[model samples]
Target: MTFEHAKCPLCLDQIAERSRLPDRGYQYQCPACGGPFEVSALAQRRAGKVGIHPGARAKMQQHLLDGKRPRVVFVNTTPNSYYEVREVNASEQTIIN
Candidate 1:
């Protein structure tokens, strides 16, 4: 998948590059503010399930990194909420506020 340009909402700085750690750690940082961004596996799973438009993952990651809550909308509402993810095994699967 093609990656989208990500910008930091706090500093409006574009994410230029990323470095992966040896411990299976991945982080994206803003060059201007040095804020580390997190890309959750749940978010990736959600993107895959919906076949979201290309570059959507990058945009969402940036939003989450900028301190905004990450959410995905689902079509089924009977068994679960529109924003629910089956991949999320528990309520704590999401980041705490």
Candidate 2:
């Protein structure tokens, strides 16, 4: 078996694949600070500072089910634009958003 690892930007802890959901997008919780984060293999980016609140996580999951990409939004700023979400494998690197 193989595992993917990422650093929790909030708690600065190393999160192992065991802590993540085994679905298409890797959703994980930081063991140290209990922060929620996601790594999108399609986007090839990690979204940090996502809320650990139940409602937030639910909303994110809903978006994923609806074929939307969930992005971490910071204070005092908003996403410039929205793009259609599409699934891409590791072998493909073209991203529209």
Candidate 3:
């Protein structure tokens, strides 16, 4: 299988995408951030250039520690924005606050 490469939105580390989760997003198990991240195409570009806020990273890390997945849509879009974290269970998906 051909692997697609991109930068982790949380850590900006060069990472290998495990799968294309439809549309223009990728799923990865990033080494730097120490977890899995679901990132959209545009979000990857933003992370590479503008970077993300420390608070945003902390949020994601917290979610991971609590056993949730971090779904990154955009980072620091307005200097106060952060990516979304998804809570997956046996049923519906939720957006963690």
Candidate 4:
């Protein structure tokens, strides 16, 4: 398996390979500070153009009290095309069409 390295924006430490989740937009969790961050390809390209940092992380937890977990579409455009629904977590009820 291959690995990609990126600096943790919060701790400024190089994140280890085990902490990366490539499929989910190159998301990573810093081992030192436990901060969640993403190093997106588009952001890298823009950073190359603008000469800025290429990664972003959630703000401090106290600042996230009003934030909501994004609703993700689990199933859409099925063979029958009868319904579309989103979910925030597994325990939540499924909103039907």
Could you say which candidate leads in lDDT? Answer: 3
lDDT of candidate model 1 versus the reference = 0.40
The alpha-carbon lDDT assigned to residue 27 of candidate 3 equals 65
Error of 4 at 35 (Å): 5.2
Q: Tens digits of per-residue lDDT for model 2 on 1-97?
A: 2345666433345563323334444544445533333445432232333323344445555555565545332223265422222333334322321
C-alpha TM-scores of all predictions? 0.28, 0.30, 0.60, 0.34
Reference-based lDDT, each prediction = 0.40, 0.40, 0.60, 0.34
What is candidate 3's lDDT per residue for 1-97, written digit by digit as tens?
Answer: 3456666656655574555655746667666666565666666566667765566677777877776777666645665865555543424332221
Model 2, C-alpha of 92: deviation from truth (Å): 17
Best by TM-score: 3
Clashing pairs in 3: none
Worst 10 residues of 1 by lDDT: 85-94
How many residue pairs clash in all the candidates, one count each? 0, 0, 0, 0
Instruction: Enumerate residue pairs that collide in model 4.
Output: none
- Summarize candidate 4's per-residue lDDT along 31-85 as a digit string, tens digits: 5644333434444333345422222222322122333222211122556321111
Ranking by lDDT: 3, 2, 1, 4
After the best TM-score superposition of candidate 4, give how far the Cα of residue 1 lies from its true spot, in angstroms.
6.9
